[model samples]
Target: MENEKETPEERRERLRQEEWKGNPTGNLKDSTHRSSYGSLVDFVGGMGWKGTGMLIILIIVGFIIYFLFFS
Candidate 1:
């Protein structure tokens, strides 16, 4: 009865909300991604190529520092 009374736009929005409720990917910051390396990959992917390159440079620098001081 309520569905029949709803306008087309309202029905469409309701359907979209229902679909979103069933979708696991609706929340990018959910614990599932944060529980694994997926979060790190997502972070790097969100950054452009330049940022990724910078991250690599930082990692290499970190490794070099560790080797120089600890190893």
Candidate 2:
């Protein structure tokens, strides 16, 4: 068995099975609904204050630009 070679597709399938075992909940998108504020808090909590601040600033600037020119 040690001398036998695995095909590329077989190796890929084995790796995928191992990853699936580690994460039994493969459906990561099946999350509960959250309010906008709650979602924002969760995002900030997941990706530190600096990242969250930059995102907020960008969103504010985008809205301002939209109102000034697009609207």
Candidate 3:
């Protein structure tokens, strides 16, 4: 019996082929995977895009006021 030795590039190509067979996209997919971060984004997004934009702008203004005056 003989073992075939492959080069690094060949091994990488083989792994890529296997990965593409599973998920063509570069993103990994796991059935059990639920992101707390994405949930938070969704929660904030429920406030509506316009409201979210206003809230973000208010936060920036508040920070500028605090830093320039209070600090």
Candidate 4:
């Protein structure tokens, strides 16, 4: 600390750069979020049953894989 020599503006800009280094945000809104809840419900309901069936299929397949390949 005693030997540090950065100017205040340089220090402030460095701090700003450091603060911004790891923060990432999407540059735009998802098209999905732009829809109303009613639309979302309709969209999700349209696929909900199929997705649930697929999930069950996946769980069964995963168990098969575990026994055949791992156990």
Candidate 5:
């Protein structure tokens, strides 16, 4: 059997596919896999669309209350 060498791009694609398949080996760290959002965004995303809207509404209400009472 002939062993074929994979290019860096191919290797990254293969690893990304494996990660999507739920086989996280934890050997390689790919920048693309990292989220750009901070913990707050991650929390809001985890809550789904409806919860995200609700969170936004609550934040707006809180800001309004803060400005009216203190600022």
Candidate 6:
């Protein structure tokens, strides 16, 4: 029998499914497979001053775009 090689995405999905099956409650606090944004939020929150600086920069950029195009 020829073994079918799984793609990276397929492997990731399979692993995610296995994780879900192992934890039917879907409680993210105990799960290792956090969503990308959840990981980002956790990282930013941990950064303290650096996180605040990034957020301020993002808000400034948003205001610039809004005034240039929308207003």
Winner by TM-score: 1
List per-prediction Cα lDDT, in the order shown: 0.73, 0.65, 0.63, 0.58, 0.64, 0.68
* lDDT of candidate 2 over 22-71, digit per residue (tens): 87676243233353235554466566668878988999999999999988
After best superposition, candidate 4 residue 67: deviation in angstroms? Answer: 0.7
Q: Would you list the clashing residue pairs of candidate 1?
A: none
What clash count does candidate 5 reach? 0
Per-residue lDDT tens digits for candidate 5, residues 1-71, read 22168755456556667786674444234323444333453465467789989988999999999999997
In model 4, what is the error at residue 58, expressed in angstroms?
0.5
- Which regions in candidate 2 have their CA more than 4 angstroms from the true location? 1-39
Candidate 3's C-alpha runs over 4 A off are: 1-38
Give me the runs in candidate 5 sitting further than 4 Å from their true place.
Answer: 1-38
Cα RMSD to the true fold for all candidates: 11.6, 12.0, 14.3, 16.7, 11.3, 11.1
Q: Rank the candidates by lDDT, best first.
A: 1, 6, 2, 5, 3, 4
The superposed Cα distance between candidate 3 and the true structure at residue 39, in angstroms, equals 4.0
Clashes of each: 0, 0, 0, 0, 0, 0
Q: What's the TM-score of each model vs. the native?
A: 0.46, 0.42, 0.40, 0.33, 0.44, 0.34
TM-score of 4: 0.33
User: Which prediction has the highest lDDT against the true structure?
Assistant: 1
Residue-by-residue lDDT tens digits, candidate 4, 1-71: 72288765457556655655644232123223444333443454455678868977999999999999987
Once fitted onto the true fold, the runs of candidate 1 whose alpha carbons sit more than 4 angstroms away are: 1-38
Model 4 regions lying over 4 Å from their true place:
1-47
Per-residue alpha-carbon lDDT of candidate 6 for residues 35-55, written as tens digits (9 for 90 to 100): 533565446555666777988
Better of 2 and 5 by lDDT: 2
